[model samples]
Target: MAVNQESLLKKYISKDQEKQTGQAPRRGPGGGPGGRNRGMNATGKPKAAKASVKRLFSYIGNDKYKLIIVLICLLASTVSSLGGSYLLRPIVNNLVAPDTSVQEKISGLLSGILLMVAIYVVGVLASYGQSRFMLKISQNALQRIREDLFNKLQRLPVSYFDTNSHGELMSRFTNDVDVIGEMMNTTIVQVFSGVISLIGTLALMLYTNVILALVVIISVPLFAKAGGAIANRSRKLYKSQQAALGGVNGYIEETVTGQKVVKVFNHEDISIEEFQVLSDHLQKSQMNAQFFGGIMGPVMGNMSQISYAVTAMIGGILCVLGKFDIGGLTIFTNYSRQFSRPINEISMQMNVIFSALAGAERVFDVMDQEPEAADGENAVKDGVMDGQVTLSDVTFSYVPGKVILNHISCYAKPGQKIAFVGSTGAGKTTITNLINRFYDIDSGQILIGGRDIRDYSRSFLRQNVAMVLQDTHLFTGTVMENIRYGRMDATDEEVKEAAKLASAHTFIKRLKYGYDTMLEGAGANLSQGQRQLINIARAAVSKAPILILDEATSSVDTRTERHIERGMDRLMKERTTFVIAHRLSTVRNANCIMVLEHGEIIERGTHEELLAMKGRYYNLYTGKAELD
Candidate 1:
């Protein structure tokens, strides 16, 4: 009876659900930086096998010249091996015949032995050539794949990263890509060799004796069935293994980055317990995957032996009846062994092929995601921005049907400082986000210099808008290099100037290596205040027309904040600036202060004007109601 693939898949899913219930969910192994987990769910959707395979071959076709050479070498190597086997028949039937003279027999046998060695040598050389050539081709293809993946990441919107974890994405570069590399190095070449060898052996066997050849052909289906069953089981197991490994990796990344929090909260023991559960899942899944894959070799080997035994029996009966010669029977048996060897080898590789295809499917799925919205044909090409920002009836929600900002209208004239004071989640930072187009508003007209922000190219728009966020991140580099990241073409003198303007030069000069000091893991060696200072210095170097400080000074002390405020006052002198802060003191010098409630602006004016109003702003300023 034919199997119902859909029903089989549903049954597998049900069993997997039961297994998950009996055990904890998987967490990936290892630790590194802070990042979210972006791995697929353990029972995530399976990819279509045929489509994935076809897509995988498209990558292989990238280096067609090398692939063609590899094929030629592989064919040459296979043909030499098969031809050497056929040469055995002539050597046994003629050179060592009973009627031959001793002297002549020795001469013929010596020449034939030399010819076989020559053929074997050629086969060895061709195999080596193909191996080396394939490596180059495979590595080049992998490089393109990695490049495409990373470039795709750059083009992807921030919203994509918001939903995915850093660890999960990292796995695609490591585990999945590694598996594909291994398949290309070993399994793929073996598959080519096995196929060519099987075909040649079949033709030679039939030329020797049709009856015995038919017997070997009969066992092909049995071998295929057995191999197919193991491959199916192994494919499912490997998928779970990959997912479990991703889970373990994600947990490690999160725990390592948050170790300080874990220790402060006295949760080390609980963390270890959780890690153990994830590690256990990975172990079990890997063991099961390997077990199913490992059985294919032995099962195929036994089937080959069975085919060989049946062929030998029929050959012996024919020889006894004087219908076949001893030399021909010997050649026929060898051909029977050669024919099944390829079948067995092909079956053994089915598991690896399936696993690699599954990994490719995962990678392609990420690459296939929709990229960020592109610029319109008429998008601003001149890169001129006046820094006069206006939002008219802007409305947006991170999620649909749940509005965060409703019909919000605001404006920041050129060369003026605008301050936003609101409780948490009151849309202060969201306004700044809209100005840069990190995300587009659902329904709104956000204009910079009277032109809609969407009319400007995203890169050009962002280049003109510099933001200093509450959470500062620094890469592994010298202090000078980190500052230069704001403007790659900035001069050394300019970097020093920006640092001075941010009040960071004093602290940087006190460091052992000064500006040359190398930072690691987002500058873990530096204090939070120091990191924020560097972040501000970076934005200062950009000299963008519009500046946004979203709680930029939140990490500094009152004394430090006072010192930085003086530097910030000078920095904001001629730039259009937007400030978001809970500390009312930070916004006291603003040209205008807007007090927001929920998603609407309830009060708008200078500090004294709001104080005189005796409304929501007055209450917040006086501490009657805290800034939530």
Candidate 2:
């Protein structure tokens, strides 16, 4: 089976890589789809490279003073380095010339040696100062960039996370940001120093002998053309490589998180094959990008060597003929070597620069996303709420053109328990989502306390409504800390009281260290019923006026479910409660029950009334038909 899957993966990837499809392999139907389609090449509507680079530099805003100091140091360092080499000419010529007196030659040699040492000392100090300043600037700019990216993520809409994987977002924080840091600290310095060295050497060469300098200048365009072509290819390959890397990480995380299911279903072979395919794809992209990028350095170096040989031959001829002085020839030879060094260095670093830019563009693209829309000025700020909720002709769709909730109207008075019973996909959980304003309805009004829910600030509405989802997510903290997450300011006594109210106190007492016991892996160390009880305890501690229990008792055994139901009964009093459950017995005593099908409410009343109607709800309650 592994062999067969491997063959299939190979076939898929061969075709996939050949076209360079310029896109990642498609994810499964309900998986986290790629969200970076807009600016990256995946969308085919990529933003201009230069514009993104310009914006990335804007993150360095307000550090201009440090940058200015760094620039001054850089200039001083470059000039001193060149001056040391330039001084070699006079030092040698004065000692070698036959017409000079012994005393004059000795004096010239000593003075020139002292100046050379002084020049080197100045260069070392300037270089050190530049490095110190750049370190601070790079770290500070990166710090600000990371802060903005994180802050933007918090404000982004839920729809964003729906489409993007946790791994992809994490890559921005880890891999991409690290690349940017490398560029700022190392690549930027190398390029700046290289360019200054190149230009200064070329100028000196031209002053010493124009003919030799012309030979060096004429060969430069060839290197430029080669470097540009390689850069283009590497840019595409690096972008593809980064995307593939993110895909691989997402797949690994998914498989690891669901490892039990994979083992139960005997899917090990298929999983390995798929992972191999992704890994192979990444290897191929990296190989091509590195191959092309690596060629430029050698090609530039060879070109420089050829130019150096030509200049050496010409300068020797000019010196012998007395057209050029020996000192001038010496400087010209060194300058010729210096002239091509920058081109070679820049060629070698093109790949690093390209990658940093691509990563920065991705980070900036996320920062540029439209954040969750803020509430209007009339939004409630008083933090006061009564437990009244009404859904007036609410309509909504997660996907356009496919309605999930259709003109559903309902009401719940204060202190009422309203239960929603429906087949899966009947918008039961969506209703709770709407009340909390996780999503706004298409054409309807949701009111809390006789006012539009939209009129309340999102934070305020959420504070008033507490929800316990089917899947409980507990952080890596003590039991006490997890319960207190519901109400940050709640005292330990209050948390324990909430736990007691939710019937979790009995279990808490049995556990070692009681409330202080640490939980990990979303409370994986605990039983399913225990986790759900903790979840209920979390909601109990919230002290909200409105509550939502979504299949909260479905995962537990009959005895545990009874305990949970009783705890919920106590929680439901004096609050407007919304319950969604698969078990019919859970909703039997509700003040009202609404049965829904195909996005519309089809039945309403108590359980006895629904049973009397002998409608879809009756069929479900009687077990004649299963919930889809």
Candidate 3:
């Protein structure tokens, strides 16, 4: 079954917020289908391990020369280690032979010890070089992976963000990528070295005594069976643990961000209870995952010990029967132990390998998603939009067979103020979304400047439009810098002028450092009204010919709204504007008012003309009926 990470995270956050605050959770844009699965097979193994590994290596391939050096170092280190152990056979033989004098034996022992010491010194240097080069290679590969992931996110459609939890996406960058890095740094080298050492040890064991080598080889199946079984169980558990961890992380982020809401509704206790459930789930999953993973070491060790004991008893018998020299029996027993050491090492590394593969699969899952549709050939790239927009016979849906806008048609001439007022879920904001090309209409023609909207590059189309949404967001920067964000090249004087037009200049001047004061955490230092004013100011500086204001004035008071309206009147002149508001009075002077009901325009006229018609707009305005 596929894991819906966003739903898992949202379930905890929304459930608590809804029960205590009497507010529904915000759904994904378009109320579309759930997210894709996490790419796990029925046995809990990564569905595309081979593909993921191939792609991961592609990133590492960029540093080919450094990787070559790391490989050479690994070979050098492994050879030195094996060579030093093999030398023990001759050294023991020369030291214990019955014909050797005491003085000769002491000289032979010192010479042999010196040779082994020299080989070990070389091994130490090679090991150090291997670590240094591999670290560089791993870091370079990780940098590229992170860059690609971030770049892909930038090109994704807005709908993607709506459907996926922000915290889960962040985990891909942090925890997932971190595990991949760890494997590259240590596990990759260890596995390669272990394989080489195991092969070399087996060859030496056979050269010393074929009987002993056969005995050691017989234990190989036991190692494989035990390791495979443990790995299979732990793999599934680790995947579960990772999913649970993502959920807990996402919930904590949501709760911290919305702590004020929790306190206001006195839902702290409920929030705690919900958090406990997620936390407990994570703990149990981790406990099981670690238990299975941890046992692979001891299980392999015990089996190796049994194999070693059997090999030693047989080697001792061969020595007593004069079929093997004392020195050969001693070295063969040592080689037998050395043979099992690599097997044990590789078995123990299975957990790291599984973790890294799972992480790589998750990261690749995002990279594999289709990005926003590319702009067509011959798409307009360099022209100012005339601000004329029209939708004809438009049909749209966020999900299949569930139309949100049905056969909607509308027209706005250049420099016109078109206002849409309707009950929530009546497609008020959705119309503006279509105009901005945030989503494509299913079957219809949306024209801008008398040309099909799809004829323009998405970036070029958006460049000419500015939006002020209901929720305000400010980057971590000074107040002046935030306003200037609307237009990157705006001068300081232009920024201040825009702030004045939004009625924000006076309050900005009252701040401790005025316009230069730094704002962080999305402008937490500012009041809601102040933050909304800054957002309006941001739109004012954009100088785009087309503007969208969705609940832009809902956060401000009547007096402040009046000030904003007066300023907006100046800004809106000679520009096309679309307004979505709940307050009927706000659209009174609009050039045209569109009253939508069930995704269809039920009334179209000026505010006064609609009020005179005694229709839906009339009832809504006179308190004769509620908007909902």
Clashing pairs in 2: none
If ranked by lDDT, best first, what sequence of candidates would result? 3, 2, 1
Better by lDDT, candidate 2 or 1: 2
Q: Where does model 3 exceed 4 Å of error?
A: 1-43, 626-628
For residue 533, model 2's alpha carbon misses the true position, in angstroms, by: 1.6
Regions of model 1 farther than 4 Å from truth: 1-47, 626-628
- For model 3, the local distance difference test gives 0.82
TM-score of candidate 1 versus the correct structure, residues matched by position? 0.91
Between which residue pairs do clashes occur in model 3? none
**Candidate closest to the true structure, highest lDDT:** 3
lDDT of each: 0.79, 0.80, 0.82
Q: What TM-scores do the predictions have?
A: 0.91, 0.92, 0.92
Model 2 clash number: 0
lDDT digits (tens) for residues 581-606 of candidate 2 = 99988888889999988789999999
